[model samples]
Target: MALRLKSLTLASFLIPSNRNDWDRHLSAKHNRILIVDDHQDICASMRDILDDVGYEVVVTGNANDALEQVDLTPFDVVLLDYQMPDMNGAALLRIIKQKQKAVTAFLITAYAGSTGAQDALNIGATAVLQKPINVVELLGYLADAERA
Candidate 1:
């Protein structure tokens, strides 16, 4: 899939100017989520769904960029693909936890029985979501995360 950029005004998301501003922004109903998947189509589709529902969405195809974004911004939730060429989602979740334990992380995979799925749960993933996720369930998780 080709890489495509979709822009949303930063002001719409209310980019925080300081720590207090960030805290308030996070407490608002409009939360931010990060989608880390190797497939471009998956990222785009997920982003569109979340964006339509009033969440700020950021996506990347690699763990490195995901980690950088995690450091730079506070995400209410992270939807991570379980399989990746560079690193598995479980390992990436560990790194994200180390960086920000407050960020809820979910593993997305077609293979629920895969060791990576078990590892992700063991390493503190909020949940493991099977591929072709139920939009209602996904939104429920996001809502719960936002409330936290």
Candidate 2:
């Protein structure tokens, strides 16, 4: 697969002043994150968001590929979208936890207030984030996960 860069508006997520802040709080080894989302733009946007902040970011448009990436890589954390065409995030998290119990995972979704959040958490998500994720909250979670 080819790795392509997406053009994005950086200001929408990361503040110029805080761009280096994420790196300051966490090292590159502890900052790797895998993002699984069916929407190409969302995946690209998130990849850019984390990448700009100095974290290694990997993204996949489907659950199958995301699973393969997990098996092949050693990501410290994952931010998985709740909805997808092939498989739901909860199912993916279950498989990941079964394969690697120590892996940290978080389910991200617009349906955060719904039962899906509970389902994902019950399955194995270390945490859940409401969609249109708050940057500060996400950074806080990543920082905490880095320490753990």
Those runs of model 1 whose alpha carbons end farther than 4 Å from true positions after fitting are 1-28
**What lDDT score goes with residue 1 in model 1?**
12
**Top of the candidates by TM-score:** 2
Global lDDT of model 1: 0.77
- lDDT scores in order: 0.77, 0.74
What lDDT tens digits, residue by residue, belong to model 2 across residues 104-132? 78888887766777877777676677777
List the pairs of residues colliding in candidate 1: none
Q: Please, what are the lDDT tens digits per residue for candidate 1 over residues 1-148?
A: 1011122132323344576764664456777789999999999999998886678999999999998999898787898998887888999999999888877788899887788888888877877878877666666566656655
The superposed Cα distance between candidate 2 and the true structure at residue 133, in angstroms, equals 1.0
TM-score of 2: 0.80
- Residue 86, model 1: lDDT of 86
